[model samples]
Target: MPSEPQPAPYLPDPRIETIAEWIGDPVAPAAFPRHQLRWHNRRWAAAVGLDGFDETRWVQHFGQFAPLPGNLPQPLALRYHGHQFRTYNPDLGDGRGFLFAQMRDAGGRLLDLGTKGSGQTPWSRDGDGRLTLKGAVREILATEMLEALGVDTSKTFSVVETGEELWRGDEPSPTRSAVLVRLSHGHIRIGSFQRLYALEEKAHLEALVAYCLETYPGSPPPPGAPGREEPAVILLHQVVERLADLAASWMVAGFVHGVLNTDNMNISGESFDYGPWRWLPRWDPRFTAAYFDHSGLYAFGRQPEALLWNCAQLAQALSMLVETAPLVAALDRFGPLYQQAMGRRFTARLGVESRGPEQDAALIQAAERAMVETGLAPEQFFFLHRAARNAGEDDFGTLLRLHAPTVAADDAFWRQDAPPGVLIDEVERIWAAIDQHDDWSELHAKVEAIRDLGRHLG
Candidate 1:
């Protein structure tokens, strides 16, 4: 029998030249074989503007991409300071990762194409610029799942399994390495601003602030606008609003980012790193995901507070760029913004038709208490709640038993003929929307409807 040859990798539009030309970086000579990697589609990457990125070729090229003409990303060795695990660490920048370049999407949104585990550079410091295959796979799964769950997150553009083996103390010996391309707004962290503040470089801090404002022009100006005197207060307020909104989103999704270090906090307010992150299965306020979280600093219930703390760090850093009084006042708005966001999130999740702060609070508290007392998995309960209108009590009982066995004892509680609450009507509305749709489109449309309702009610 004759043997068949493998197919060549599909090369999409050779606009790689355009991307290269934009960055002025030459494509490195080394090329990883496409067969040696796991390729996944990034909807957001397509939503942005990246196309035809060969993860395998990218891994093979490694650090050589910097010197390639028309392909070299305008490399910036960012300077940043951070408090890692509560202690100040002044010398952490792009330890291994680097921002390759920025590209404008069809919608005119600027997205940064950055590389992780692309090998060592001047900032590598006593570490290897490599990411484990397991780490890469975990990141891919995390990104996909989070996006589906509607969490504001960075998209993984590509993942390439390099043929070379590396060693890591955290796992078994001779671990495989991989490269990850992430599409994000920018990599400018709170630490980046802090670094300049530490050096007392007011000019640089102001420059960074200006750069941020230019990057995210839609951001509302702080208290004092065009004709107003103090622009720093306005800038501070804008940052506070974005930070509050991001924190609220995280809380709504039950996401615990193991590390909330200043370096991990993005000024543009987007979830970036997936390291040591976990989605809460149940509504436990104390759930911690990161193994090294000895102090319970970044727990599920504490995420909002942790974010406020990070925002405080940012405020301190911005003091170098703005006045102290306005920064403090701007920072004060964190509580109100978070409260409003939380109210909106909870409202949607419960499908409450009427808006009443007291009523909403009571409903949320009741749900939380019921979830905890019943030991129900948060996701399962919410999923069942979304389907409750048509599925009937028995169906919900079956689902709860299948997905969250701990709540089996409470089947009677869930099935009891009680008066209709906020969730009941909401569930009925969501189910009605699903019922009206055809079978082929019902499942997807239903899930989306529930999610949309959750967003509005939350």
Candidate 2:
């Protein structure tokens, strides 16, 4: 009798390989992957088939620049050109990062593992390819808080303290450096298509469109778009829905992703590359997140506009391959999608099932006005109103009474002395403790508290 054969060991199934040629440029990471391990997302690792990976295995794949099994043979530095602050910048790309690998998540969705501060590439024109430790810390915090707020955002997969000191004008000089790995939905940015259009590679552009539609599948096209089946028009419609959700989600989360460049906008609608991001201290529509955003282009309330503009650029790129009418029809759906998504998200964040879009809109408007008049931080606003907590207060009484009664705030989280806040001052204090004392206890404590908040929000 013959014994039954056993199946081979589990390995990640990837899709990036199929379109690697037309999408990315093969490149090796600069220098050795010799960074000291600092933080690792063990939970995500298990979902991606690297659960048992030790320090060596982890650093080899993430820090030491070694390729992973069933993944790309070498790292790929993706090419993209974006309209930075309404100005066309052909020189922009992955200047300090590259696509490390791609894998499927537990839910069978494709995910990308990308690197930041691994090394420089051809796009590293005049910059030192490095990431400040503060930047890595900030990204981890941003993602954690955003996820807690139910925003579609990237997870900081790993943080390795690269043994290097980098100088920059933004932060303190001689600052520590780190290499970060991010696990995300996908790395295909809207700018990726812009580059193809700029090069006049219609064939590559079409191929890229097909690859995107097949890879990052989104909602079906709207009813009015006659060419819903057309690859280019369908993709345009899908990206519109996604970016609309992203913009609405951010508005509900009180987040401002300072840089809304076309390159920063992902086709999958997941938020990543957190630079100069901020949560609103109060409900100020004119609040700007970036220090140099003199024009308030990507201000807190204007996020939807910025995202809509980026999607418009994507539509413009797709125009090179498809007609204007269907694409334009798809583009027209952004405003309505944003409005409805915002209503839904706000109601959910308030811990109430949305009764109707109009009611939800009214509640959101009332809440916003109350917060602005009372000078309440967004976190405090949401926390205090968790199922309409403190509903009897002068600040929120009438506003909350205008709606159907919400679930009572019976959870222990509502009884907490104070809710967690990661505003700029709070973030600065966390960083100050690290910089001045070299102590990370506060950072670890904050992350734990953030997870606790997520649990409470559940």
Off by over 4 Å in 1: 1-35, 52-74, 221-229, 350-354, 387-458
Q: What's the TM-score of each model vs. the native?
A: 0.74, 0.95
lDDT of 2 by residue, 73-140 (tens): 88888899999999988897888999987777655667788999878888888988789889998998
How well does model 1 score by local distance difference test?
0.59
- Please, what are the lDDT tens digits per residue for candidate 1 over residues 143-207? 54455455567766666666667788766767667777776676778887787788887776676
User: lDDT of all the models against the reference?
Assistant: 0.59, 0.83
- Which lDDT value does model 1 have at 64? 37
